[model samples]
Target: MSDQDSSSSSSSQTEEELDGEMDEETNGEVEKEESHRDSPAQSLSTFSSSLRAVIRIKQKYQVMKQRRQEMALALSGAGTFPGAPTRTSPKIFTFDGVTPSAFPMLSSSNPQKKKRRRRKRVLFPNRGTCRSPPKQERSRAKYCLYLLFAIVFVQVYNAIENLDDHVLRYDLEGLEKTLRREVFGQQGAVEGLLVHLKDYLSTYVHNKPLVVSLHGPSGVGKSHLGRLLAGHFRSVVGETLVLQYYVLHHCPQEADALQCAGDLSAIISEMVERAEEEEKIPLFIFDEAEHMQDEILDALWTLVASKQSNEYLNAIYLFLSNMGHAHITKHMLHNSSSTSMASGRHSALVKELTPVLRSSLEKLHQLWSEANILPLGLLEKGHVMECFLDEMTREGFYPDHSNIERLAGEIEYYPAVGGHEYSQTGCKQVVAKVNLL
Candidate 1:
């Protein structure tokens, strides 16, 4: 009984050991299967990243190729040689894991050696040279250039077509009479000045500056003559003749003689720069000379003198002052001790100038000595009457000589209360008398 019981125990122990070994083998097989599945998924991820990189490289190559072609076209238009050709397409290659035997295999050779005999050579072709772009890209570039030039040309032509002539409005009849009396009358000192002016203008045309001063009393008409001369020059010279007319009233409220220097300097610099660039001379006309600041006058002197030194600024400089010849002469003497004093006294005479301009009086004297002074006088009785008659004619009113003479007599006798006073009643009476005639 003891032997049978011991045999049963040993059999049971052997069965338990066999079951443990089978479990270990099954677990090992499961681990091997998991590792094999993970390998394929990792390979797929690597292939996807490589494909993306290749696509990016292809896109960059295409962009570079397009830019190269555009540059070539631009260089051709600029009359320059085109650059070297560039690759447009990506390259492709192929390889096989096979090789050819050096010697023919005999029927008696080893089977393994015979099986490994055949091999294939790898090939890599340049795909960039194989393909050509369509001709439409070249045509499109040419069309763009043509459109650009056409638009630019049209804009330039339109700008030139929109310019108009510039003219200022004033009393034309009064201006004409003022000029005739000052330039042609018997007692006219302006007659000698006229001859000198003609010579000066002739010299001015040959690139010489003409500095002229017109001085007279209030009613003697220096401003009217100045405007007339400016108009005459503009009418004959078609080139850009810029006119800068300065009056005492035109000065800004904040400006004093010294403070106005910057403004005046800027104006002169701008004018000179314009003249230099455009090849045009500028005419500077200063009226109401009595009101000009001393500093302003100094600036003008500097500009004129500096321009005189330069070959370019042979432009006309006109000065119209109500200050008489005595005033002008005294100012000149105080400013300069040169022969300008003799010339100022002999060439021009008016009444008297203000003493405020004494500081730059020498510059004024030098200017007068070098320049031609034209003195304007009052109108003659007949010329005055003729001017009135002409004004009446323009208004569509005709007057006989007898009636005109009666009206002239009234104007002459009551001149202080009537004609020259610029009254509405005076103008109406003159108009009525002309209508009756």
Candidate 2:
């Protein structure tokens, strides 16, 4: 009985020990499972912190790179490529209510779309082929610019021309009126002189001096016309540029011709030099040119010839001569008709008389060949009466028309065509007759 009781007790004790060991194993397994779950929470916290730190570092790196690129662009005049990296503030990431493992899934949600946008921003050109301006439009703009430049150039050119014309003013109209009013009865001579003067004075350049020869009988106003021209030129260009020389007064027949030529040449040289310096045209009138010796004419020819110096070429020379008076008087008495006295007939008269007058003067000097022969025609009886009236009025006396007619009728007249008579002495005695009045 003792042995049976002992055996039963041992079994119970052994079973109790085995049960305690099993409970210990179950508690250890439960503690391990709880520890494993708790470890996941701690690992998640650590992973989230590390992930935020990594993101912050990457954002810092991106910001630094953007700043570097911006600095480079600024240093290079800000003309960098459009897709070049630019500066931007870093975006702060919040992991609230989100697991660290879900970060990759969230970032990858629209990977294709992100990649397309990045490529478009980084590689695409700012201006596309379709957006570029057309070649035709560009050419039109260039053409418009050229046209505007051309218009400005043309306006400048015209302004310069107008200014030049104003500066070189020659009052031809005033000269014409003065000649027509003051110089009477020699209509052809006045017209020819004016035409030549107008053409020569219109421009500032000349190849040679203009030489005009006035040929007629004595007492036919040759000296009077020379005085008028000298006065006109003096008024226009001042006194220094006008030289009125008389053969008898300046170089007498008894004086040495060589010395007289030298004096005349010096005077002409001084006048021309002064005129050129002042940009002016000069006038020279030689009265009684027929009395000038060969030496004097030769000196004049040197000055007035085509081969003269540039400064000497810009002058007007008037030669008053009685060399062709005989021929001129004969031709006028033969052709003195009312028809021949008209302005239209003046050209025919010039054509007929130029050869004869030029031939007569050329016998004296070859210089006359180079001259423009202007013949002073014989005055009519009516012109003589008009002259008497003019002289009477000029000497401060009241002109009596009947007395003028009587004085003009007393002057000898040659027979003319159409019963019109011309005075033989063309107002030469009118001044003496007026002084007697």
Candidate-wise lDDT, in order: 0.50, 0.77
Deviating ranges (above 4 Å) for candidate 1? 1-193, 203-208, 238-240, 252-256, 276-280, 306-312, 325-370, 399-407, 410-437
- The TM-scores, one per candidate, come to 0.41, 0.63
Per-residue lDDT of 226-267 in model 2, one digit per residue for the tens? Answer: 887887778879999999888888877655889999999999
Predictions: Cα RMSD each: 25.8, 21.5
How good is model 1 by TM-score? 0.41
RMSD (Cα, Å) of model 1: 25.8
- lDDT score for candidate 2 against the true structure: 0.77
Clash totals in order: 11, 0
Candidate that would win on TM-score: 2
Model 2 alpha-carbon drift over 4 Å, by segment: 1-170, 337-344
* Candidate 1: tens digits of C-alpha lDDT, residues 1-437: 34334434443444355445444544554455456545756676565655665565566556654554464344334442257332222223323222445334643476555454532112444557659764654567788899999999998766544221111122233334556654322134445435544454332233456677766544344665566667755554433455645655557453566767667677666765665564445566788776777677667767666544343355667788755545543343353333532343423322223223333344544454545555543333454456457657767766567656667566432232112222112222444556565
Candidate 2: RMSD to truth: 21.5
Check candidate 2 and list the clashing pairs: none
